[model samples]
Target: MDGQWVEVADRVLVRRHAELDLSAGLVVGDGGCLVVDTRGDERQGAELAAEVRRITRAPWTVVITHSHFDHSFGTRSFLECPVWAHEDCRADLAENGAAARDTWARWYRERGDDGIADDIAATEIVLPDRLVTGVAELSVGGRRVVLSHFGPGHSGNDLVVHVPDAGVVFAGDLVENGAPPDYEDAHPLGWPPALDGLLGLLGPGDGTVVPGHGDPVDRGFVVAQRAEIAAVAELCREVAAGRMGLEEAVQLSPYPRETTVTALGRPLDGPPPAPGGREIMRARSWGCPG
Candidate 1:
């Protein structure tokens, strides 16, 4: 609805913003508090930090769900505390963080959003200081929270934050609600399995799932989205192996054409490899079998 604290469970709150319809989370533990994501830039991060202060005076530890500019860029405002993320997250930021920021900054500027552009330009990239390759147990105010990098999916660095005590899962961009799945940097094949791991961790029954965007959802929602993801994965393999044509695959995909194209273009953990000469010529001169 708005970027206010909407409690999903005990001591767990998801703040949904209207800007990108993105959601960040706050978990208050007796020892300290855990901020699921920082936001897009310094200004937004400061605003979130202020709101968090109103809820609890506890010191905060940040768990970045991914390296995306929106979910991870707003860490400067929380420098007094530790920031955690998947180990690959650090590498992803180090490799492409500046370019990513510049890209968004220019996009906003071209759209006449100078203020947002300037804010993004001014926000220094804050890479996660603590890294987690596997399940890393943490304690915030005596309560336990687990951070796990299920596998390469939304990105090579997607991390899911689980609060077993609160029975809530902060499923970064792994499970989007307000929008279709973002496939710009996704591993379509691996995405489904990663989601499966999250499902396994949640282990059935009723529980809240705080997606990276939109309002928090339930287990059934994740299940349905996972099924769509599974369809995409199957289509990817079929298309890659030439058993399914791009246009036909697009027609059959669970998402829109553009989203399906982007998702199918990427294979596993990185960008699509350069097409061969024949492939390039075929695309430019004549259409391929469809």
Candidate 2:
């Protein structure tokens, strides 16, 4: 799918990029359109913009879900539109934008694709003009779209676009469809509540949910993921409580056990405990115990 648009509801379009199969949404209201998340780089973002133009000629407003390179770095290509994001996302991009560029550059070089990496390096990070704290509502084409910050889940700063009228939520990196959830920069303990907030906004298992990395799913999928997350949280708690060693916890976890264990700041079995001892303990105490 070079780029396929699925009509999510009456006027919402969920666009899935064929390159990485990354998903984004376009909401058409009476006045204009609201874009959920941009693509990875300039070329990709331009392609998505073209798709939007093909569907509707209305002016667009962009909301970035997080500050990851794949989602926010492409905003520069959509510079003409007003961009919105969490305040921490802006700070992250400002502080580590160059480092991200360098990391991607090295990655592409290792794959013998210097041009792709160079293009990523050339991509400028665009910060959001409208920064949000907890929740903010905006009128896009006359329809009310709610942007809520569900604490820290996938990352310290993550946003989910909830269209109550449409009953569709554009979840950035909070939920994944295939492989396993990415916990590299994730708040393992806080992730469950973030998902809970997403489920809460949905109100019921009736609307379409467009995830950052897979095909759109229903409320049932979200609920199932919640259970998986809960299990991981329990394993983290076990490690923190010394009831289970890191390796033992990883052995017990149901989802990306190894990755989730390490991301929770736990030791990789026999090694000395992590330095940020109190933080992990707090996370375990606050996380789902069952």
Candidate 3:
């Protein structure tokens, strides 16, 4: 809730929101600056923009980490500027943004948080103007910010923003700290490989990894989380391959049973989730799957 900027590197700053403990990045290069993953709504985005102004007045380009409402909805406030995200991110927002907005709005209403619901409803959904599929390089001020989509994991649209100069990876929802991974729209079987790609990007040593929410973490943290995902992926693979039963797999899961059930329930590469995905997505709290 402080909305203060925590400088991780020379010019790379992170503003960790008190709400949801959401963290967004601001990289000040030489030419222009880069803002990673806008907040939840227009008000929040405006607040973020103002916070960035407190740091620098350089023109800013926005890179969305994924299409989740908390990360993409506030994007409209930064409109008229270049907004970047995975291609699937654009598609997801274009197709489901409104529905997600309505669902979250209704959810808040049910919880008697009419103020939050109203803010969500009032915020206009904005899709990415530019898209990143594999990897896209950009000059933020004078620094290089690499945006990458390492297949599908937390979400098909998850993008990892790597700041080599800063030795920090802005790992959106793909890597969550202080909470369990959200699998509402995750690719369970593919999540581990995606994390493997992240580890590869990290290379050697303990570089900083900023999760979507929570405090910044180190490589060891990611490694431990990676193993959890790997176990989940293997379990899902075994289940899908008919070598294991879902119930038995649940018993052996590394995560809590509910979280494990949710992870296993996610679609790997098949038709679609067996319903409840939307509701789970809508009901997600602090960007964490319930």
Candidate 4:
């Protein structure tokens, strides 16, 4: 919905879209704002910036959830403002940023949108000026915003922003909505604990949760997702131990079969008649057993 805003609370504004939504928070005390994540590219981010202008003129600070191209690559549009992200995010962008750009550009090109691919190729990578290890606090318009690094779950680096007073948390890709979780770069073993940390910080879903994608949900939603993740982790353990074939594990997955297989951090041993028929194994040992 272009030029539209959904107010999660008095302080939180969410711009919704079919693929993903971007969240921006306003802190009334210091007359400052914190943008959770930028959009996919310059044009998308510029559109988001225009939405921010409609709400408040407060100086803005950006908190990147992770370094994925869709979330962090668009930060170039907001570079004049202060940007904050996990330290590993900066390193990821430095090492693999160009490769990510090329990959996505090819993806868009295949869709026959060469212009979009070119736009993505032309955008510069933006790194965070400020980095946090465990936690960092800032006053935005006199309101306190807590930026905490949960752990190596979704990615080696993932950050979630908590506003205690307003009882809102901007949970990055740590949580997804409707779509299956993407764990190609995720620590499947460590992912459950990251959700645990989010639960602990947000107090059992009593507050509002602004996920990196999808509509805002309550703590119960997270709790349900956590159960699903636990099940996937269990399946991973089984596949690793040879207790279950990859096909069986995929069938038991709470998420889509393809996503479950990829998140196991391995590839199929052989080709299957169908996409999910072959047994799978982890490429590297993760030191866990069923």
Q: Provide the TM-score for each candidate, comma-separated.
A: 0.92, 0.88, 0.93, 0.87
Off by over 4 Å in 3: 270-290
lDDT of 1 by residue, 1-290 (tens): 59578888898888877667778899998869999999889999999899999899989999999988889889999987899999988887787788777876776677677888899899898888899998899998998899988888887789999999888999998998856788777788889999998988787686889888777888999999999999999898998888999999999988878778877887655552221111121111222122
Model 4 ranges with Cα > 4 A deviation: 1-3, 19-29, 266-290
lDDT-better candidate, 1 vs 2: 1
Q: Top TM-score: which candidate number?
A: 3
What does candidate 4's lDDT look like per residue over 142-210, in tens digits?
788898887777677889888888888888877877567766677776778889988888774478887
**Model 4: how far is 251 from its true place, Å?**
1.7
Q: Relative to the unseen true structure, what is the C-alpha lDDT of residue 140 in candidate 2, on a scale of 0 to 100? A: 96
Model 1: lDDT of residue 90: 86
Which residue runs of candidate 1 sit more than 4 Å off their true CA positions? 268-290
Candidate 3 per-residue C-alpha lDDT over 145-217 given as tens digits, one digit per residue, 9 for 90 to 100: 8898888888877899999988999999889876678777888877888889888878898989999988898
Model 4 steric clash total: 6
What TM-score quantifies how close candidate 2 is to the native fold?
0.88
lDDT of 4 at 211: 76
The total of clashing pairs for model 3 equals 8
